[model samples]
Target: MLMVALCGAVAGFVLLGHSWLQLLIAGALGIIFTQFAFLAHEAAHRQIFAKGTTNDRYGRILGTAFVGISYSWWMNKHSRHHANPNRVGKDPDIEGEALAFYEEKAVPRTGLRAIIARKQGYLFFPMLILEGLNLHYASVKSLVTRSEKPTKGRFVEIGMLAGRFALYLGAVFWVLPVGMAFAFLGVQLAIFGLYMGASFAPNHKGMPIIPAEVKLDFFSRQVRTSRNIAGRFWPTVLMGGLNYQVEHHLFPSMARPHLARARLLVRQHCQDHDVPYTEVSLASSYGTVVSYLNRVGLAARDPFACPVASQLGRR
Candidate 1:
């Protein structure tokens, strides 16, 4: 709450100041929005409240209104991800798009898309510069395309998103020159996207990609597929408890404050069960993700090769 208040105050002051240099505050606001997004994510998981309805209410407000993302869209997609992390054909996170998490997804790529797939690891961070825009676009797209489905708070989210963008864009245009306003918005979105991608990409990207047909117990599925960033204070604060991703996956409803202790318990349990528990430094995890993506990209370079061979190479 204090941070929220501080962010609003600083943003208000900076907007009224009319200084180009104050665009830096826009970058800071991006980081702040990502923090709110994390809170929204937790709320959606029912970690912030006892009742599911209460959590949904707050999740909608924080995600759609404050963070300019659709709670309904995120909830549906993220729930699927939690239910099947890194599982082929099941986990939406690993679904083939611009970047392929699994090798087979890369095999059919051609032309520029193939080029991107081949070097996606190196371009991942740069690609994330558009993630903020992508999130907003995807949220609205989900709502529009899935209108026939019964979505809780669908119209309400649309209204909130409309209002949120109205006020945000209104303020930006009102306070700054047209050119500067665009630049300011660009910086904010870029930073928000980059930070979000950086925090999330390390969690499961380099970890095992489970076959869709393979059935695993909950403990094994969550523990083996997730990787933890080794840290206590700063990582927890910066990543919004995402650094404790292994523990987070095991206990989706676990509150941020308890994740650290949960990590120890989860790690010991994994050790006892002889399950692979991955914990690496933040830097090391990033390198692993990049290397992993590059290896998957190799499939695009050789389209005729056996997919089984590529899968074997991945292991």
Candidate 2:
């Protein structure tokens, strides 16, 4: 993790020095950092090393320095997300102010709110970025106002988050020239924005947002709750193989590089077992999401209210 962070920093410094190289280096390093983010995620789930402690320790270090996130917070929150994905009232994954899934009770039905609700998907990208920051702020607030004693790991996570933020500030204000600093920040922001946008949209959106009343088996839930993108090599590399959303959700322990193979394996298993599986090409899947967003602004509605087996069906 230290080595990866150092390499990223050196690449970033080179990007700062050369104006023309900014975009190339930024894109490259952004991909590197994005991959590191996945590694941190894997570690948080104790999927990286044989020992849970080692996995957590590595996750914390890499998450703080390379990804600028706290692993402990991620683990706690993400566990909840996985446990209750798309459950409107229960899932923390619906932390974004712009809710994407509709619940019968929470439906908005008037004037501007109605308009926003109708076109909710279009605003999802910006909302996602805001929600990421919101999550950080909310976590810190929770930590400070807690009446009960915090755990040692929680304190360590908070401290690491603070340090990472400080380092980011220092890099922007003190380490580099104004222009260079802004460039670096811009690059980081681009990466952050892209990461959130690309990785999230396909997982649950455009799928049936079921009510808690719907009793789904484990395999059914896994298949229904996620979509798979048959992305080619370049896109897979750029997105850190997150395009294989269904496979990742099912086996979060597997490394990103192995997702495609896992997807194939899962597909064959599902076929043999007579289980339903959803797969769409990358372009079509992304297009479905965009079209949905264009139709629904920021309000919670079931994207898969009308399910189409293929992208053409959506059209």
lDDT, candidates in the order shown: 0.88, 0.65
Models 1 onward score TM values of 0.93, 0.78
- Model 2, residue 200: distance off in Å is 2.4
Put down candidate 2 lDDT per residue, 143-203, tens digits, no spaces. Answer: 5565565544767767777887787667555756678666766666566656755776677
Model 1 Cα shift for residue 20 (angstroms) = 1.5
- Candidate closest to the true structure, highest TM-score: 1
Which pairs clash inside model 1? none
lDDT of 2 at 115: 57
